[model samples]
Target: MKKIFIISVLSLMLAVSVFSASKKKYGKEITVKETTKISEIIANPEKFEGKRVLVKGPIVDVCKERGCWIKIGSDKEFESIRFKVEDGVIVFPLDIKGMTAAAEGIVSVKKYSVEELIKSGEEHAKKEGTTFDASTVKEPKIVLQIKGEGARVDGK
Candidate 1:
């Protein structure tokens, strides 16, 4: 009887996760003028650094831990940059993944220490129930993140 109960509980947990992942959360709409290609901005980070820009793209990854950050690219297959909200200022929902979003924020090249990267990797692994090897993050890296001021997710 105990074995049966354990299996039932595991199944229920799996179902719940699946249900949650399938749900999409749309955020408040803000008027933004997206006038630059993300690629152009990325190619010339120096020109746009510290400047606020509106970028539109499908979210490649959402921070599973707190939804405080997202990696959005111009195209699904070719995008590579992360945009994060100022701590405690905005909290995006994890369900926003795969949704097209337009975000306006100041672009900056944020640098991270090796230890800080390790901690972030560990936190993300815990949230996803996976294993992360901190050693894999070998050196300090520059991450281009947008310090968001306002944003919105398009209809799913």
Candidate 2:
């Protein structure tokens, strides 16, 4: 009886250890730098790819169909860094445009061909009943993820 009880206790301990190990392996938490620059991210996308990144910038535009994404850059002339909401995540309000925001999420790389971008622009223009110039259209690599709350709309 004594031997059987000892064996049962040992088996239970082994099972608990295995369960804990499995949980740790599948769970991953990410931390992002607070002041990451678009130039740096573009220069080395691989370094930040799939990792949570925090960035602060003005919201240039918002898409009702595609969802909320911000363009990050010093000026509109420079190609803006685009960050889109990730899958299975709720997007922020569209009124965020023109508001300075700080967001955090997993960095993703998206590639679009010129032809594809033109088609997309045309579709968007049609939906909005506005003319879109495909000639000036740019196919940019984008980041997809969640936007965390950081600041109010007033830039305070």
lDDT of 1: 0.76
Residue lDDT tens for model 1, 86-152: 6556777777788787787788887899999999999878878999998799999777777777676
The list of candidate 2 runs beyond 4 A from truth reads 1-33, 65-67, 74-77, 86-88, 133-156
**Residue 106, model 1: Cα distance from true site in angstroms:** 0.6
TM per candidate: 0.65, 0.56
TM-score of 1: 0.65
Clash pairs for candidate 1:
none
- Candidate 1 clash total? 0
Q: Candidate 2, after superposition: displacement of residue 51 in Å?
A: 2.6
Candidate 1 regions off by >4 Å? 1-34, 76-78, 87-89
Best model number under lDDT = 1
- What lDDT is reached at residue 49 by model 2? 80
Per-model CA lDDT versus the true structure: 0.76, 0.60
lDDT, model 2: 0.60
